[model samples]
Target: MSALRAPASPGTRPAAAPRRAPLTSLPGGAADRGRRLDAVRAPLQATSGVPFLVLCAVILAGALLAALLLNTSMARGSYEASRLQAEVGHVAQDVQSHQEKLRAAEASLAERATRLGMVPAEDPTMISIEKRAKVGVGEADAGADATLGP
Candidate 1:
């Protein structure tokens, strides 16, 4: 019967043994065990997305706050600019009114001068001074006579 069994094919290979992991090579190795102990001793680890979501929320809140602040500042600036512009316009109008009042006052003064017998000078005289003339210090008096000719 043994001779009746066909000889094993030289090209065929035997089945390999089922491998078993050693105690140290188990699923929870030293590093995994330490991690497990740390988890038990310390607080639970946060979800992977919790911190990322918190950071996003913080960034979004910051952006909103910045936008609000910027908008408020811009609004204040715009209001101030408009107020100043209005003030400038009022000041300009006041200046124009003052100028008109001054012109009217000047005209009234001229009319009153003419009514009070103040006439424009027909012949205006100017005293001439020559280099050869010796003007004494006492000649500065209003009653002193100074001649223009040398």
Candidate 2:
């Protein structure tokens, strides 16, 4: 005769109990218990116009800046173009006046030469006013080139 008791195993360990979370760690704790938290956030969730409004505001600001820059650049370009045009006009007038003066001087010289009876000789002579003499020549032949027909 023996007591009917089961043998205990020496290699097994006891099971661990389930741990509870700390009471103070609940979200918002006791302060969020009043009213409906979901209802407070309903307006934000239902509204779809906020993002569109923000996007429009950004685009409008960008357009305004672009317009301002374009206006400034156009004004500057116009000023430079007008200034250059005025300078060109002034230069053209100066050139015309110089051309008239040159024509008048040529006319005056021709008239003076005619009044002095300096006739156009059949054989015209050329005299060199340079300090150097002709190289490799016994006599300086001046009118040799002029004798050739134009």
Candidate 3:
């Protein structure tokens, strides 16, 4: 209220306060100076810091976006690694199957040879080059020459 306002007096002004009387050419009346001060300090406004807050929000949003992208990329890499592992498993199974087939073929080798009328030799002999004749060999059976090449 106007009644409760501080009265215009030298007592109200601080002892250390400097005056702008020469520069501003203020009026000599104490009432005018008091009113001028009240007008200067009336309904004072300050910065709302909207720009700083907006910048901080933008930075935070950018960080969150980067994190989301990073997470998505890592998940994609994980899925790719899993897929490659599955492929390796399949390839391993294929290799195992091939090894099994080779083992089966090796196991049937002797049986196949018997079916083809091939037999293991009871005695192994060789021709002597110096003597120009067979050596350490018994006489052959009558049909032996038919199966053995000359």
Q: Can you write out model 3's per-residue Cα lDDT over 1-150, one digit (the tens) per residue?
A: 876966569757645776665655446855665654433454567868999999999999999999999999999999999999999999999999999999999999999999999997777666677666555564564324322333
Question: In candidate 2, what are the lDDT values of residues 1-150, reduced to their tens digit?
Answer: 377855657987666889997656357744567644443344645767989999999999999999999999999999999999999999999999999999999879867999999876554445343533333332345434423222
TM-score for each model: 0.47, 0.44, 0.45
Each candidate: RMSD: 14.2, 18.5, 14.4
After TM-score superposition, the amount by which residue 103's alpha carbon in candidate 2 deviates from its true location, in angstroms, is 0.8
Pairs in clash, predicted candidate 2: none
Question: In model 3, where do residues sit more than 4 Å from their true spots?
Answer: 1-48, 113-150
Is 1 or 2 the stronger prediction by TM-score? Answer: 1
Q: Name every residue pair that clashes in candidate 3.
A: none
> How many clashes (backbone N, Cα, C below 3 Å) per candidate?
0, 0, 0
Who wins the lDDT comparison?
3
Q: After superposition, which runs of candidate 2 have C-alpha atoms over 4 Å from their true positions?
A: 1-48, 111-150
Winning candidate number (TM-score): 1
lDDT of 3 at 149: 33
lDDT of predicted model 2: 0.73
